[model samples]
Each structure stands twice: as C-alpha cells, then as structure tokens.
Target: MPNRRAALLALAAPMLALHLPLHAADAEQAPAQLTTVPGPFRADAGSLKTYQAPAWFRDAKFGIWSHWGPQSVPRAGDWYARNMYVYGSDQYKHHLAKYGHPSKFGYKDIIPLWKAEKFDPEALMALYKKAGARYFVSMGVHHDNFDLWDSRYHEWNAVKMGPRRDIVGDWRKAALKAGLRFGVSEHLGASYGWFATSHGYDQIWPMLGVAYDGADPKYESLYHRPHNQPYRNSASWYTTDKRFQQEWFNRITDLVTRYQPDLLYTDGGIPFGAVGRTLIANFYNASIANHGGKLEAVYDHKDIGSGEFIREAGVQDVERGVMEGINPLPWQTDTSIGDWFYSEGYKYKTTTEVVHMLADIVSKNGNLLLNVVQYPDGSLPPEPQQFLKEMAAWMDVNSDAIYGTRPWKIFGEGPTKAAAGHFQENTAYTAQDIRFTTKDGALYAITLGTPTGAVRIQSLGRKAGLEPRPVKAVTLLGSATPLRWEQGDDALTIQLPATLPSAISSSFRISF
Candidate 1:
C-alpha cells in the first residue's frame, strides 16, 4: 500500500480538509480555492462520487507517456536526482566522476544540461501513433520539482531552464495534429518528500558532514524547503508541511488552468485531501467548458483496491500492476519500457511481452499507458524506436481486436497464473494462454504466443457454458481463410493455418 492509502484510512472522515498542522511554526496553509468555472463536480466526496471517466479515455485503450525530463540527463535511470546525493550509490559515483560532488553541483545544475535540441515532436508523435497510441501524455512535473511546461506559479520550469522550450505544450500540439487525445502527468504531489535526499550531505569520509548544494537557501525553491522528518517511506511520504501542501496545490492548479488537458494524472491518489479534490473539480469544470458543456476530462487516481474511493472521482490507475481478473470498472495500468526514465544499458521489455500486456489489459477492461523513455536531447533512442516499429507491425493487423472492445465473460484461460498487484509486470505465458475481447458481432480470442497446431480455449467450452451463442466462424486476424475449429463440451478447439498473423501474439476473430 502507498502512503496516501494509509493516510486516507487514518483520517476520521474520507480525508476531509486533508491539510497539515495550521500552527505558525508548522507553516499555516489550507486548500487552494476551486476554479470559478461552474461544473457538476465539487471537492466534496459526495459530489465527486458522481464523476465519470471520459469516453475518449475509455476508448483510447493504449496511450504512450513521455516520462522524460531533466532526470534523463544522467542516463542513470530513475531517482537520479535523489540517489546522486547519496554517497557510494551508483548515480552518486557516476555523478561524482562525470559532473562533480553534490556539494558543488546539485540537481539544480543538471537542469540546464537537458537541452532537448534534437526533439522533433512531429516525428516522435508519428511513431507513437503508428505504434497504436490513441492518446499521449507529457510529463507535467516530476518529483525533481521541475515543471516540464511554462509555469506561471513556479520559476523552475522548462521554459526558463533546461530545454528552454514548452515541452508539454509542444507534445500536446503534436498529439492533436496526429488526431490523438492529449494528457499530462503530474508527479509533483510527492516532490516535497521525494526531494528530501537532496538536503543531505555525503555520509562518506571525503565529504562527511559537508552539506550538499540543496542545503543553501538560494536553491531551496529548486530542492524544496527543509522539513524535519525521517526518510522512512510511509503516509508521511505525503508531507504534512502545510506550506508545501499549498505549494503543490498552486503549481498543479496553474498547470490545469493553463493546459486544459483532456486528462490529468496525479502520481498519487487524491492529493492533500481537499486540496487535490478541489484541483480535480477545477480541471473537470475547465474540460467541460472546452468540450461544449460536456465533461470529457479524465482524472487518473492510483487505486489498487476495489476502485471504491477513486471510482467515485475518476479513472483508477495501477502502476506496473495487473488485476487478478477483469476489473468491474474501467481502469489503467501505467508502466514504462524500463525505468520511468531512460537508464544506461537497461534491458527493455520485448515486443512479445508488450503485446501480451496490451492484449491482457484490454481483455480485463483496462488500458496500458506505456512510458517510452526519451534521451535528454529529446531524440528517440535506436532500441526503443525499434521496439515501437515492431509494436506497430503487430498493431497493424491486430488493432481491430484491441481498439474499441470490451472484456468478455472471462479475461482468459491459461496455465500461467499471474501474481497480480503493483510492481508485478512479468508473467510467463505459453501459447495456451488465451485472452478475450468482444466488439459488436465479434469475439476476439488472442493467444499470447503463436499456437503450433490446434489450440483449446476452455472458457469457450460448451460444457463450461460461458459462451451461449453458437460460433459461426473462426478466423485468424491477418489471414483471409477461416480456421477449422470445433466447440465441444470440454473446450473450443481451433486448427492453426499455415501462416500466422503475428509471432509476438495472435488474435483470432470469432464471429457468431
């Protein structure tokens, strides 16, 4: 469980006025006021319970997220900003050799190194669209306390530093030009605590007791102001420092007000209780105005449970996780190619694994928001670009099974039992693993791998009585000829044609 969930449970109510201590010494603060835009939703739990996931988000089952930012500058994987300050850590040693010590050169100095000179949004968006991304999300703000957009509330932004370009705005334009929905992800909710490592000095001999650059008051804005707390990850991860809480609200509110994104993804759950809820209400109201008085905005809240709390307000998201079975409500699984950011020599997920994940997620009434890591200079790496090309080829023929489809009676029938939950991304599935999706008059049975001969789907068996409708035709998606098949009391068996549509994953279209 995450810190937010624990905090929510401990609250006497459903996180009403989820603010920190109001004492002057603690930095007095309260929830930011809601936007003037009138809408059906409100900050209250009762009002937000009526919130609905947007139709665009439901249909856009596959989205590509640019989880890129200055953090990619090190090419040392995720948490570089935090880990670089820790003595003897991989990123720390790398930074010490490549740049300098944290006391002299901190994360603030690394910001200016991210000059995305080669970033061509048009080309990148084209690749993503071809890779079957119906929606694209730009990193709004990450835990490094850097805003990827031109921020009015924060000076540490892309427009002023790093790329000196409006990364989020440019990505949105490219996404729209390619006829895809655009969204923004904000990881700023936990930045206050996530960045606390920067405030520390090296524990080792050469630099022991010497404060890092973040200890200086001049860099406090870049690395958040100091807090008195242990590094233990808990509900406290969401800081109780009221001023920081209000800062989170103000900056994210500015992002929503300026960007008016089709979707808004908070890295954590309804942040700062009323503060986060109010921002969500404001985002929804703005989206309604932009869409001719209709609520077409999706608020992504990370909910690993029965989607009870988040389903009341927005689309529930699971990070690097899968549901045991089909989710009753529409959900999303946000994962990355390797780490959240580009890492040196990272072994990426194979094309087959990605296809399997997509098929499985869509079958379980969920979407896959894969993070395609980017280089610091805004250019696509060769390996990930190749990965996209392969994915595009697979989607070219099987997209009909993925897009605009709903889950069937069962998610799938397989010998491999997936350990479902957060951070469990890998599952070994044989050709026997079959996933199902239904659209109109068609039922798509997608095998995780190429079936050698005859394949049996127990879930479709006559005795199992799952599929009441008689099977009229069974054909491989990329093939024109119908496959010879049988529906018996035990299972639905089908013979494979000489050629297969995709070796990565096969989708058999069953018409009844």
Candidate 2:
C-alpha cells in the first residue's frame, strides 16, 4: 500500500492525521479477517498476483466518474465535510458564513439540502457515451461515509435520504442501456480517520469548548463513533481501530455484493491490511461467479508510490497523475475537470487539456477516469457540458487512436515531460509533443496540442532504431488527403495541412 499521509497533508487538513496508527500498511496489524465467498484467490499478495484485468476495461481507454454527493451541497469544492470543521480554513469560512457554525449545522445537516431534483442518469449517460466514454463510475461512498446507493448495511443512503433515488442502480441501468460499462468508487476505508474532525470544539470566546454536532450521540452513525485519540501530526492516515475496520469491510462488502460493479476504485492504498484484502478477494470471487467463472472485474487503487509499482494485486490508479512510462499491466488515472465537487469560482480544465491528458494516459497503457463536476441538484454546469461536447467533437476523429489501442515500442517523442506519480498533474505540452499508440498493425502519433506547420517524430526516425521497419503510407486521421511526408535517419517529418479537422489536437495514422 502506498503511503497517502502526504495527500491528506497536502489538502491542508493535517489535524485529521491524528489518531491514525503508524502500522496502517501492516497486514499483521489487522486480525485474520476472512469472507465467506468462495474463490481461488487468497487475501495475501502471492495468491492475488494471478489476477488479470478484464478485456473490457483495457479496451475502454476512457471512463467518466460522478464524484458528486452531499459535499457538493456547499458548492465549496473538495473535502467540505472535514475542512468545514477546521476553524479558519476556506471551506470552514464558507460554512460559517453560509450555515452558521459547526456546532449547529454539520455535514449531516447538509444532507437534506442535496435535493438532486434535476438529476437524470439516463440523459447524462447518453451524453457521456456520445462523448466517447466507454465506462461510467458513480460515487458509491466517500470519506463522508454517506452511501450514494440503495445500501443494505447503512441507513444513510441515497435511497432514504438526499434525492431518495437509487443513484448507483440508476447509473448502472443507464450505462448498460447506453452500451457502456458501469463501475463505482468507494472512499469509505479512510472515513474512520477522516470524519473524526466533526468531534472538535470551538476555541473562540462565544463557542469555546462547545461540542460540534458530530459529538452528539444521535448522529454517531453519520459522524462516526466518538473517538478521543490525540491528533498526532505524522505519516499515518488510516485508523487503527479494529471496530472501524470491520465496519468498513461490512459496508464495502455489502456495496460490492449488491451493485456488482465492473470496477471498484479506492481513494487510497488498500486499507486495514487483511480486512481490505479479504474484501477484494470476495469482490473477485463475486465477479467470477457473475461472469461465468471468468474474473471480469477491476479493483483500482493508488498503491503506486516511491519506487514501488505493484501490478499484480489490482489496477494501479494514479490520482491526477500518470505513469512515467508504459506499464506492463493495465492501469488508470482518475482526475477531475474542476474540483472533485463543483465550486463557483474554480477554474476547470479546458477541453484541450483533457484531450491531451487522455491521449498521454492511453499512450502509456492506462485509462483516464475523469470526474465530471456536478451541482447539488445533479445538473451539470455549462462548463462541464461544454467540455463533454467539445471532447465528443474531438473524439469524432481521434476515437480509433484512443480506444482499443496499446502502447507502441515507445510512449512518444516529446519535449514536454509529465511529472510521474501522484499529485503531479500539471504539464504544459507544445505541438512538438507527440504520443504513440498502436492498434492492429498501425501506429498512431497524437499531437498534444495543435501544430502550426510540419511536425517531426524523432522516434519514427530511421537512426532512432525505435521503429526500424519501413513506412508504407502516412495519413491524417480526419483528413481525406494523403499526408506529404518524408522520412530521414533523424526524424519522420510530415507536412501539416492548411486546415485540420479538429482544433483540440490531431492524430496521424502510420501504416508500415
């Protein structure tokens, strides 16, 4: 498991790191937890290494995610529940000015405010399908511990609260109707450690020592059980409480058993050691049973960090980042357009940036799970809708290059280098940046940005030795005209047309 204490610290919520055990990644730290489900794989790494990603997930290079929930009710971006109780943080100020203090109006109060009146899964799924999304993931649960489905274990779910809709079921139906795969993300593992903030008290003169709404016994299920562990600023982010680990296992197992999602994404590394592993084993067994003895499910997690990159356990998920090079096994990169949740003043990623990231990720043998930010009502703001439309227009020409493609001999020839690993998402690429992907017997060279004139692909050059085969023909993806090209020992130069099909980026098909 990759240590994610840095992620929490990066969020400006370091106090949440308190009460976290130092041995979070220790398998022996957890009791010998086991699931009743039958399967060939064990909860240990050696047995689970035989797991392989299904063909559906690999062929589907792009997926869309709805990271929406009650947190969006404040329209205050990511981590509203935790930050709102941090005294003077941005979300805290927003919460105080808008809905009084944490003592009165807590995250529980924000639940009913999330009336997804305009939420339409069918229509949105259709739009995503049109935008070239081959798979869709809905938020099954977040660190808020609020389930966004018709949950069997927990009572605080979408079926009974908020919109009173079966969010996950509706999404699965809609995705299947649109001929797209369905998946769900679970952030419940770290909730035990994260939601402890709700138990804080105000230090100000008026509200000094006043218990927040979370400390009340009535809302224990929502805010979590009352814990008095001192906040230790350190690397641990997962709680050591065995009880919470059991709860996490039960809730997550219940979610997987019910929905049977094609994919399951955990926010951080596999949590609670043996507890998490057994849950995964059950998930895999269930997938096999559902798919006629074939494991057709993908379990995604960010277990890649430092010098460790384990491909055997499950698909390695890079959050807002990409692999340094082409990986041997299938993986994914989950990112968002603006904030994880919608914010009024936040600057969203442009269509070109999204396209570039998708291209880069696909070239490196990974899929991009993009989160389309939505409002509390489940209606998309104009920005995200426009982003999807623009992406669809771009995919009109470049879809073949992206989907069902594998990494070539080399990822690409580019001067703009993307910082590898987690949280290093921002990368500025020029027209010279070309990423490579292979399908059938052809090679695809995608420009990260719009090129002005002729472009040179150094990797395709004869002397480069990356592509030693002779080139038979060259053609642009959207253009009908054959490209005027010349190959040299140094680089393969292709003359650009006066007008291109799409303004976002371009893909050139090379047949050798």
Candidate 3:
C-alpha cells in the first residue's frame, strides 16, 4: 500500500520510499525473511529455499470472501480507522452524536456494541456459493483490534467480547461443508500505522483526558504498543516505531500456525521486517505439508517491489482496483457494491454493472472478489440481497463461460474500460465495449452494454480481399437457440434476435 500522500505524489513524480530504496532492476535484496530457505514445492523442497505462491491460486480464477466483522456494528461504512479521525465526516459525526464527543466516545467503545445477533454462517455460505464463489475467506481480524475467532494469543476476541461467538471458526466450518477452501484475512499488520489516529485527541475530563483503550497495558498486545513514543504522547501518530514491526510479525505467525488458513491476506504490505516474510514462507511450506502438497495455499499482500523474490512472497491483492494491462500472473481484485460495511441509503451496483465488470476482469486474467456489506446483526440489507440474487442468476445462466475459462488473444474489444490503477475512480461501460474469454476452443464474446441490432467485431471478421475463418456456431448464453453469424473480410457480424435474454449485458459463444 502507498503512503497517505501517494496519490498526490503519483501526480508529481512516483512516490519516493522513506524506508527502503526504490527497487532497481538488479536489486539483490532477499524477501523480508529466509533468504536461505528453498521453496516448499516438490521441485525445491530439497534445500532451505523460500516458498513461492502455489499453482492452484494462480489457476483458480474466482473466489469469494466474507469481509464482515465487528466494524459492521455501526451499520455504517468501513474506513472506521480514518473516518474516526476526521471531525466532520459522516462516521465521525455519527460517532460524536450517537456515542458521545470524539474525545469521549472512542472506537474502543464501539466494540461492545457489535452483537452478531443474526449471523448465520451456513446461510451466508449458501448464498455465496450460489453467487459462483469457488473459495470462501472470512475476516480473522481487522485493524479495530478485535479478533473474529477464539484466540489464545489475544483474548480481545469474538468469543471473549461482543458477539461471544467463534465467528471465524464457524465460518471455516461452513465453508468446508459447502466444499469451498477456507481462508482468513489479517489487517492487523497495518493497525500500527493506520490506527495511530486513536492516539489523537483533546486533553480535559470525561470528554478530554481519556484516549481509546490503546494506551492501557491490558490491551497493549491487541493495540500493538509502538515504542517510538510514550503511550500517552500526542506525537505517536507521526512517529514510526520499529518495535511494533516485530510485534506485527509475531502476531501474524501466531495467526497462521493456529488457523492454518488456506489463503492469508495482509491488508497492506507484509510488515516492514524480514521476519514477516519468513513467517509467510513458513506458512506456505507448513500448509503444504499439512494438506499433503495437493491443497495449495495463498498469501495476499501488497505488491512490494516486484521481482522473483516478491513473487515468492505470495499473490498480489488489489483492493477496489486492478492491475494495469495484461498481467500473465493471476491476481484478485476485491470491491463492494457500496460500502464495505452496511449503511442506510447505500446505493448498489446494478446487475448489468457487476456482470460486465466480471466479464472484463475475467478476460484480463483476474478474479473478482465482490464484498457485500451485511448488517452488523448478520442480515444483508435488501439492496445487497438483490445484488447477490442477480449475480447468482447471471452465473446460473453463464457459469460455463466464466468459471475455468482463459483469456483469448484479446481481453476485450470495447470503448468502455474499467479503471487501471489502485484507488482509481470507477466508470460505467457502454455498448461499444466487448470483452473476450476462451474455453476449450470456444470464444466467449461479452458485450459491455445492451445493443439493439447486429454486433460487428472487427477482430472476428474477414478482410475485403479475403474470407475470414467461419464461425461454426454462435449461441447466446442462457438461450438454447443458435444465432446466425457472417464473417466478412473486416469483421464478424452477429445479428441480435430483436431482444436480449436478460436486461444486463449479454454474451455469446462463437465456435470456430
């Protein structure tokens, strides 16, 4: 993850590193840990080489995740860390009004309010499976310092507090029963820097002197005591503490060893030290041994200076965005219809929007992990429910074209393009865009928008001087009838039969 000023910096020159030097072409640096270790795969298992990402994740293009946790308690947006800082943001305003002033009602108080009253792991798993999720990941913990599992390392967990339930455990069980691989996300790595806001406030009385429970020693492990400044100092937010770096490494190791997560996602870069990288290597090797080397594992951290060393660290996860251009290596993009957490009056993406986005992403050799914001009580809002239903319906009709498919010569032929960078603004698509994917010699052409007449694909047609390869058959997914196609020298034309099978974007399989 880039720093707080990365966007602005990107507008100028590329952001300069404050900690390490810019990664150069001949960079000889080893990953954060275990430079001597060999990869866990059978080919490299003879020596102590670092581990590399498993093949299953690179091939299994689609997976789903349950990002919900105590943070959803307020029924607001995610960003609980940053919003809790700004004095007038919707979340900040809500926090001041409902709980008390910011100085008095810190987010720590928000913990006890999280009652996963309606949480039903089985039901949610069923819905996710119907939506075409091949694997399921649940939040093990977030930056809020709350653990969703029964943790022996940290008692400030679901079983010990608010929900008084083993949220992650139940989710794992449900995912396994549904025949989906189980994974866990740990945002704890960034808490040291991101949650520094909790230390900022006024100094007075019931409304002043008190900070969030972070300063208290009882919660130090949960909050991660940074050594750069005294616990009570106001300067803690700006200062970077090296001690917390080690703390991050230790806690993550604990998380991996106990849960043995098939997939592990760090919210940001794996902690600053080589130790964190070592833990990652250990996790991959151990998981392989535990599962007899057949069940592959994944570790999703940010793209830390790409190289053979970084690739060995784990898979890259883009949050709310995707990599630019055609990346041969597999990747995952996670986004939500509205907020990452449930909110009142939240507008969701139309079914057309989601389906088109999925088509575009899959064609680009990436998987889409769509996060739906369920209410704190575990009940999904009406809009989210409808969104999931529509997605499931689309998948029901087009699953064959999406799952287990590979990209064709081109990802798509369209004017409507999705964002190409991290944290970039999302845009809508038009009828001109067409994404392409392939499976078993079949070409899946996805129209980004609804078209009323014949569609012309220049890449599919013959030239004026010569005949193009003829399309043996053309069929719109979800429909039994075959459509007529003509191959001209310059384009392949498929005539629409007056109406589309669905209101959303439609796709057709062209067999050569």
Error of 2 at 231 (Å): 7.5
Per-prediction backbone clash count: 0, 0, 13
RMSD of every prediction: 5.0, 3.4, 6.6
lDDT score of residue 30 within candidate 1 = 54
Better of 1 and 2 by lDDT: 2
- lDDT score for candidate 1 against the true structure: 0.81
lDDT, each prediction: 0.81, 0.84, 0.66
Q: For residues 410-504, what per-residue lDDT tens digits would candidate 3 score against the true structure?
A: 77776755677656537688877888888888888888888778888877875532224567888998887668778877778888886677677
- Deviation in Å, model 2, residue 347 alpha carbon: 0.4
Residue 324 of model 3 has an lDDT of 58
RMSD of 2: 3.4
- Model 2 scores a TM of 0.93
Candidate 1 per-residue lDDT over residues 1-512, each given as its tens digit: 24322321222121111211133455455545545457887878888878777777777899999999999999998878867765566788899999998889989999999999999999999999999999999999988899998998899999998889999999988999999998999888777766666767655587766888877889889887766532335454466666877788888888878877888888767777777777788888888888898899988887532112457688888888888899878888999887778898998988899889888889999999999988888887887899899999999999999998999988998898887877787998899999999999789999998789888988877889877887888888888977899988898899888888788888888887
Q: Output the better candidate (2/3) by TM-score.
A: 2
Runs with alpha carbons beyond 4 Å of true place in candidate 2: 1-33, 229-234, 304-310
